[model samples]
Target: MARESDEVRSGTLPQATGGRRIAWAAVPEAVTAGIERLLGARVVGAVSQPGGFSEGLAARVRLASGGGAFVKAASTLTAPAVAAFHRREIAISRRLPRTVPAPRLLDAYDDGDWVALIFEEIPGRLPAQPWRRDELERVLTAVTDMVRALTPSPVDGALLGGPRLGGWAALANSAGIESGVVKKLEALSPWAARHLDELAALEESAAPALAGQTLLHGDLYPFNILLTAQDVFVVDWPHAWVGAGHCDVVTLLASVSLSGMDPQPIAESHPLTHDLDPAQIDAVLATHSGFLLRIAASAGAEADRHLVDMMVALGLASLRWLRDRL
Candidate 1:
């Protein structure tokens, strides 16, 4: 039964910016055939989902049995990190408990070169942009629910992240930022321009701010979440991390700012923030700001222009949050 949740305004999020998706026809025939055999049905039609950033293929497939399932696949040849995440998703999805509102894993295929995972396709819509207040509230509340249910992550927390989730300390000493990007970062706001160095140092000091036992979606932007009549579903687990209780909260609130929403109050009102310290929260936000700013400045590094554009928006948003509180 579809759970009837609060109703929210409908709108579209920014289109994903990345390389062309690898078509189903492009998948090695043996790989698709192997997946068909596992499902006990042949695939008749397929539609690629448009919201994710990885170079893998994520789509809903119509099976010969007249049903559907979600299939996600990647190869090291395309992007090694994506392939790694696909393998990690297989391991993580298999162990997820019922408490987490994520799609269920049905079958998996990996032959050293390519990895594919079949999931219970969720017929849910992406949350609207210029976000509706009610819709945003549900997602925030859902984060608390997900965190409460996953405090002692079902999987080992130690294997999650350090370099991946909170690698701000490394950024302070790094140097690939181009000149024009730095100028834009400096022009974001008067407060940001005046206090850039301070924010970076605080981010460095809070290097371990992401520490905790909760399994985090780590990247909790709009595209990674889905809203059904009954539940909120989070997808794309390759970036999942073991982090602070409110880590996902920080990411979620920062993202909506791109649509011109004020992030400060939204961050404060959440139940998850009740026990967290203010300084640590700012520290973590600063770290995210640094990461985004740095990524936006990468001139020639291979990146999705759309993702870079969103990063620029999010970096400014995170910085604004810092300016207001710091």
Candidate 2:
């Protein structure tokens, strides 16, 4: 039932069994050929992978003569946003010493309608199942440490684009909400509604605080982090901005809960995350819930609605676990 609910909320669930393959319009063949030629190799294989969080084409590209590269290409549909994001990533990478492991920016091209960037491939298996406490601790700790070390320079508004708060505010004021999905969210229990209200408030309150401006990964979740035998590298920097550090922290804690891990024990145990008291975690869940709701306000309204419901429920489920401690 919960899974079904999530499907409805994210708009990704409740679909027919047989679905079409996820893809983008064909990338001009010359793009791949140009990359191979630039690298002094022959193009081998270029298969597209559907990227979540951002609209782009991620290809597993190999060279006839040598190694492989992962190429992310965004069309006019997403180029302006992707270009700004890429610039932020390049700045962050430049700041770090050579030892700090991250994807090396290989090449970037702006072809008007299409903008593409390439990186040397980092190879590893995704976590096959849910992470255990130890793995969660290691991964999350690494993420926090990485964010902590970076002193984000002042971002030129014209360069990195708009404020993080703009994203939420714009979504809130938008004219459309599918009536069918709005009914589902409205039908949710008072507990869910109450939690959503608090979350909306938290997001509004946190928006101003981001004015302080620190560099944040913008999007740091399990799927975005790649773990290799040698090191952990974070990818997808489109959302990177000078914002509140806690935005990054809270986003991560909420993500851990979404991944089906209890946020209590780990939040209590990890020194890095220990600052997130029960109340703070509740607020984070609320903020995170609002985030999913906005994203699903479109065609995936059902799925986003379900995610908001689940997040509210999950936040409450953790409440009991939090009570005795207080």
Candidate 3:
């Protein structure tokens, strides 16, 4: 018998598992009908993607006609503002550069109360947790290769972060003001409570310094990256932005560190960040981690039990990293 992949053996692939994802069987009739109409085939079965913190329905669905597509659907009940991001993603993905490694958008569905999106399936594996150096290098290299296309981002539509791509200020400002948010932050780590004010300021300062036209994949964690033999596909565009180069690298750096890998050298070794100021990189780290902490602090952020657990784990880790880095 052949040996199993380490991800199977170690069970440490950085995927979003254990969330309260709505079953495809339970999705609204109109939503299911819409997906069927888009593909011209009835959905026979669905295998949910086990990553990320969204409570929406994300799965690879098999059609009656032997076809498949990655489908994600959300409603106000499952997620609050994420449905808007799904809509935003569809619009932006359609206009992304072809050379970029994102999957193609096949169709979109909206029945007033629910929204769904369909995309070409990405057949690949999540990068190993603790990140294998070779795989980490491969993704970093891919970012460098695609920079020419990613820069001068084809899409100009405003994303969640606005022009400067700075949304963490709101989260930072919530500290001390929101008693509930404070309790959660203190529970995760006292350090977060200690320096949240400064973290907020640092995030605000970094926003203006983020000067570039590149389409930044604001959410670049391992869960959003799909690695196939031929390519590395970056998925999830709801949080994308048109901002400074190597910002994704900064996001990925925090992700790597959270997984127990030391990505400090990646910052200097990767061509994407080779010439960028270290202070700017630090700013990214500080704010990104703070944002994660803010999410972890928020009550009822997601309905999925596992997704919330994943957020809490990563959120605390990100906060700890910020406390140590700053």
The superposed Cα distance between candidate 2 and the true structure at residue 298, in angstroms, equals 3.9
Worst 10 residues of 3 by lDDT: 1-10
lDDT of each: 0.73, 0.51, 0.71
Q: lDDT (0-100) at residue 192 of candidate 2?
A: 35
Candidate 1 at 326: error in angstroms? 1.3
TM-score (C-alpha) between model 2 and the true structure: 0.71
> What TM-score does prediction 1 earn?
0.88
Per-model tally of clashing residue pairs: 1, 11, 6
User: Which candidate gets the maximum TM-score versus the true structure?
Assistant: 1
Candidate 3 residues lying further than 4 Å off, grouped into runs, are: 1-15, 77-80, 159-180, 300-305, 315-326
lDDT of 3 by residue, 149-263 (tens): 8878888745435532332466556444575677676676665565556767777687655767888887777888899987898888888777787778777775666556655
lDDT for position 151 in model 2: 46
**What lDDT, from 0 to 1, does candidate 3 have?**
0.71
